[model samples]
Target: MTAYLTVVEAAEHLNTSVRFVRRLVAERRIAFHKVGAHVRIAVVDLDAFVQAGRVEAITDDRVRRDLSGAA
Candidate 1:
């Protein structure tokens, strides 16, 4: 079953302040749902948001290219 979390729950899960989560909602950076007067975020959406922010390590070839002025 999919999990739906409140803003406070999402903040706790992300180990961030509730205000930060609210900011995300305000910025529409993360997907959220409106239930009447409440806001909820899907666990998957939160995970996807985190994944979208991931930064992969640069490869050695890319580093070499940059160093050689090939970029």
Candidate 2:
């Protein structure tokens, strides 16, 4: 069974504030479930949300040089 987390738990997992997690739900930014008037977030959904925001490091020498204002 997939684990479900409450707003507070989700916040703790994400190292953020409960208000931020609530805001995410309110803004429909993160996937959540409503169970009997309670909001729950699946661990998978949370992981997916974090993955969606993943930004790979810039490793290209040219790109790094350009960004560094080096010729």
Candidate 3:
């Protein structure tokens, strides 16, 4: 049996807000199961989502310059 977590629990586990978790579900960025009106997220799926969406630290001078409007 796969362990599932409620949106609130998942958000807490991820150290994020419940709203953010809901947005992820609404945006289809994270995989989830709906049991009635409740959203359940599998632990594995959550980990996978985090791994897939992990962003590297931004240290590119060119990119920073463009972002800072310092062309």
Candidate 4:
């Protein structure tokens, strides 16, 4: 069975604030369901959203190399 999560749970899982999660939902950037007055996110949807925004962390050396010629 698929699991559903509350806004706070989703934010914790995303390592972001609840406001940002709500903004994503409000902007239609992520999918969610409204149950009465509460918003619920599907685990799969949250995973997909996270994957879509995934970025690799850059080391100091990499940053210097990338910005070598920048003024």
Each prediction's TM-score against the native? 0.83, 0.83, 0.73, 0.72
Write down the worst ten-residue block by lDDT for model 2: 55-64
Candidate 3 per-residue C-alpha lDDT over 11-58 given as tens digits, one digit per residue, 9 for 90 to 100:
998999999999999999999998998889999999998899888777
On the 0 to 100 scale, the lDDT of residue 4 in model 3 is 99
Candidate 2 lDDT score relative to the true structure: 0.97
Residue 29 of model 3 has an lDDT of 93
Q: Which stretches of candidate 3 lie over 4 Å from their true place?
A: 55-71
lDDT of 1 by residue, 1-71 (tens): 98999999999999999999999999999999999999999999999999999998999998999999995
Q: lDDT (CA) for every model shown?
A: 0.97, 0.97, 0.93, 0.93
Candidate 4: pairs in clash: none
Show the colliding residue pairs in model 2. Answer: none
Q: What is the lDDT of candidate 1?
A: 0.97
* Candidate with better lDDT, 2 vs 4: 2
Is 1 or 4 the stronger prediction by TM-score?
1
Prediction 4 global C-alpha lDDT: 0.93
Worst 10 residues of 1 by lDDT: 62-71
TM-score-superior candidate, 2 or 3: 2
